[model samples]
Target: MLIKQIIIRKKAQEIEKKSPYILLFHCSGLTSRQWRQLKNILCTFQGRTLFQPSCRGKLPYKKKQGGFIAQFAFSAGPTCILYLIRKTPDNTWSQLLPSAFYKQNLVLLYGQLQSTLVNHMDIKRAVDLETVSVFQQLFELIFYPYNSLCFCLNQPIQAE
Candidate 1:
């Protein structure tokens, strides 16, 4: 029984590694400490892995914001996305976001996670898909720039 249990656990770990990874980047006035409770609640599931970094000090990157973005891009591969959870004063979520470039995909999610805009599962399903929206024009294919516009967002888009 012990041997069987060990084998099962190993298999589960392997499956978890292959599962989708989501990085919930905390907004301004928030830190990794704030996410401690939430991480415990969200990471309990085996569907995906979550990482929230300590956005406290200055990073080596040119842009401080790029630090978290770089981490998510490298760790989660191309399928990784930085979820900006911004809640406005009037109670409605803000949609206007500054233009930014990422090695992978960028999703602007309005409102809180558990609220009305989006949920956890919705993100998993979307990233796991082949083709996704860029929310604008000028789609630059990272890997094969000459190939076509239809690029697989789920596949790993590593930095060259």
Candidate 2:
């Protein structure tokens, strides 16, 4: 798996203590740089770490044959989340779920994973399929109605 690491300094230790690390694994045909740029623009919260792993269908491996699989790793304090993103022959993206749907299941996973941390805390979290407008789609994809304290966004790409 090709991995790109991004580290952001926390403004306050209190924020870091409350924040949960987020891992956003995007689909194929997009470079880690693109994801990083989007993250920098959309993510305003502090004391968080981001990881973008370049899957097999992307750069340095796009030209190569066979299927591409990649994983994104996020670490915050003692908590960590892992999201997987893959590539399709047509270059589209999707989440890896039994039903292969985008909306409900993604949100279910997000809520299920971070329920304890987000119970009393107002932290926003979400996941969805990326649309045409990269920036707008990114924002829409992560607009969660839960907490406002910390935000955890996860995007997984499926080659279909």
**19-128 per-residue lDDT for model 1 (tens digits):** 22223322222233333333443444454334333345765553655454344333321222232332223322122122323233343222223222222223222222
Superposition-based RMSD of candidate 2 using all C-alpha atoms, in angstroms: 16.2
lDDT of 1: 0.32
lDDT of 2 by residue, 1-160 (tens): 1121122222222223432222333222334444344355234444333323333444444344412321221211212222222222322233322222322222222222322322221122222222111222233333322221133333332233
| Model 1 worst lDDT run, 10 consecutive residues | 91-100
Could you tally the backbone clashes for each prediction?
0, 7
Task: For each candidate, give its TM-score against the true structure.
Answer: 0.24, 0.21
Question: Which 10-residue window of candidate 2 scores lowest in summed lDDT?
Answer: 127-136
* Best-fitting candidate, scored by TM-score: 1
The CA lDDT of each predicted structure is: 0.32, 0.28
Clashing pairs in 2: 88-159, 94-158, 122-147, 122-148, 122-149, 123-147, 123-148
Candidate 2 CA-lDDT value: 0.28
